[model samples]
Target: MNSRFTGRLHLPGEDGYEQARIGRVFNARRPGRRPAAVLEAVCEQDVVEGVRLAAERGWQVAVRSGGHSWAAWSVRDEALLIDLAGLHELSYDPETEIVTATPSVKGGDELNPYLGRFGRFFNGGHCPSVGIGGFLLQGGQGWNARGWGWAAENITAIDVVTADGELVRADADTNSDLFWAARGAGPGFFGIVTRFHLRTRPLPKHLAHTVHAYPLDLFDEVMTWLHGIHHTVSDLVEIVAVTQTPPGEREAVLLVTGVSMTDTPEQAAQALAPLHANPYADRALFRIEAQPTTLAEQLHNQRTANPEGHRYLVDNAWLTGTAQDVVPAMRKAFTDHPTPQTFTIWFSMAPLRELPDMAFSMQSEIYSATYVVYGDESKDAEYRAWLDEAMADLQPVTAGQYLGDSDFTNRQLRFMGDEQWARLRAIRAERDPKGLFAGYLTADEPPTNTNHWER
Candidate 1:
């Protein structure tokens, strides 16, 4: 095993073993689950050999790309952890307008910067540091997802190492079952995806934004208005409403923001005009209307909102219902936060686009997620309880949950449609009958793929 791997391997109690295990994890709150051994694979062959080696030793395989899973799903007990941090392959084809990137590639920080050179862009995760592997697998809700659709929709192909230790390419035609599952299987995928072939769009020439900040006291009134009219806004604009304490501010404020992707200032202004006509603009603490912005500036703001090295507990729901029902149910999540850095977002996917036939068949017109960020280790339970209460408030209107922000060990919600979930299980049964892959880190024997309350 040592001879085949160009990268280093860390065994239990070995020097640097602990660092190799969780060094790349984004959340400060580490899990107690530990792998039997950690293999830091450097190349494609290393991944292949590592899987073969795991099979020979009868160890289940767990893969990590970018290590940014909020739940730290990569670290599993008695598994061979194949860390894909060293796989940094990236290239772009001018003719096809497709960018091929390794799974570990950071979507915002690395892939976008590289694509920007070619005047192209692939909508990736909002957090600059999130790796495309987990993000894309869980149905990436990237920037302008409301417009461009889920990031997985842009995936043209993926090179995967199957549970049987064969490296194969999965796309719309060949190995299509794997292709269908890869887009939305999340941590339950049966193979290690080495590379992603993604379709890219011509980078927008101008970026303009509109931001309206309202006092938290008006959360209901302001949110009700937004829910009623967001779908009427142009598709080129990404809209979101969030409540968080801004830098240098002691109290949290509700910020309704719209970012328009257009070629020229005139186009941007026109696309963002509807948002500027906000009824409560006069009551706003501040307003930035149709102001020019850059992707660099937008990414910087995302970094600020989701800072590193803090213990993060996140939960989300695909929401459905009228403003009258949804707005009131969201009051606790939007207004009462446990910490200053904690935030809850109301993302608009109104007039939701139809999803392609894939395993990720669950969504609603509204997406709500609460990120509880804090530093005190002793307060994990306290903060968790608070987050549970906040999310409970939304259950009256909650449809399901997105896997990206979910921790199934704490709570499990339906992440896929009933039919898609059944199809995914059949594929998993066929591809990995022996269960070589460490699937879905949950507290139960098998994840029910149903909202707990409904059960």
Candidate 2:
């Protein structure tokens, strides 16, 4: 690691150094490298002051909240990282169903207590520790996305510390452009978002989730079955397609993890049964097991922490139809499962049916999918090489990656499309003119140039 940093710096020897060096990937991609200095912000003023200091000293700055970006962009080399991870504060009101939280509050249990205080729940990605800033900014297209809209759609307002350190509120009327861009523009684009006001609603009557795993040999049949199910399910059901390498398996497995909010798990499972009764779904595997649990509990199960120090490679794209041609291509690659490594291939078409197309991209709203690869650091070279190769190999079939599972790359352009990309870039040009908070550039960069750093 390079040891040269010019500023009022914080080195490895400092007490606060370790805190800022933490990676967001939990058990993988531990950046291990530390930034030159860690700007600990307690309040909005602290954010303004810290960013102002970084700007004055000409330092490249990255904002840190839950630190869960796939690339660990939060803790990059030579950065005067703004550690907002410590600024935990929240307030939720029953009457208004409006919940306000600091960028670092993590918006799960910290938020559940408040929402539970009112017997209400706000729609968010099930990851308990995922910060509202990154998730919402990236167009949080998951479980509740089809129901409540993306995180950006649910957030009423945001308290942002801009490039030049001015604290301001952005919402529908005042900063409409920023509001639009923030919804799905991916995080760290406009500036450091300090606080957020999320719109909460009542919990559904029943939260039914189940995982159905199928053999790798029947991957094609499974894909077809999934496509058929997605084509028929009602608007309220949320389904996820995870094409991953199961434990002790050489060929990749198709795991359909679904959560339905119908009257009963039986009803939900029955609604999905037609899609499951095919040869692919019946390829000698256990059936979908349903359970009843609170939305908060469901989220906790999804993002539980584990021991650190593995690495990951993930890319995404949304295939609209059944993707008849894509199934076979994946099978050939499935056999060469990289060691200490696994992949998560998911499919969904719920969110598109739920939100207005004019505002955010509907790419993630349909039969969307992601390719995830995970392994220990020892195989970083082998896995990373495979990731790049596989993505290049798979690009002809689909485009448009999901932000929830994407990394920093020029490959991001396909999933969101050109029209939406132009709008987001325009918003970035206007609000964040100096481009201070410019860490998570889409894997697929658009036609324009984004060269100027924090100025």
Best candidate per lDDT, number?
1
> Candidate 1 clashing pairs?
none
Give candidate 2's whole-model lDDT: 0.62
User: What shift in Å separates residue 12 of candidate 1 from its native position after superposition?
Assistant: 0.5
lDDT of 1 by residue, 134-247 (tens): 999999999999989999999999999999999999999999999999999999999999999999999999999999999999898899989989999999999999999999
Superposed by TM-score, candidate 2 places the C-alpha of residue 146 at a distance from the truth, in angstroms, of 3.6
CA lDDT for candidate 1: 0.94
lDDT, candidates in the order shown:
0.94, 0.62
**TM-score between candidate 2 and the true structure:** 0.83
The best candidate in terms of TM-score: 1
| Candidate 2 C-alpha lDDT tens digits along 1-455 | 11222222345677647755673445366666566577666667777777777777766677777776766767766667877766788888667778998876666646665677777776665667667667777777545555555666777888877787898888888766666666666654667888888887776677776677777666677766566556566555667766555556566666776677666767866655544555654454666555665676667556432213445565555544345766654553443456424544454555355554323564643443333345546767776676666655555555455666665553443436558767777777776676666456443453332211211
Q: If scored against the real structure, what TM-score would every candidate get? A: 0.99, 0.83
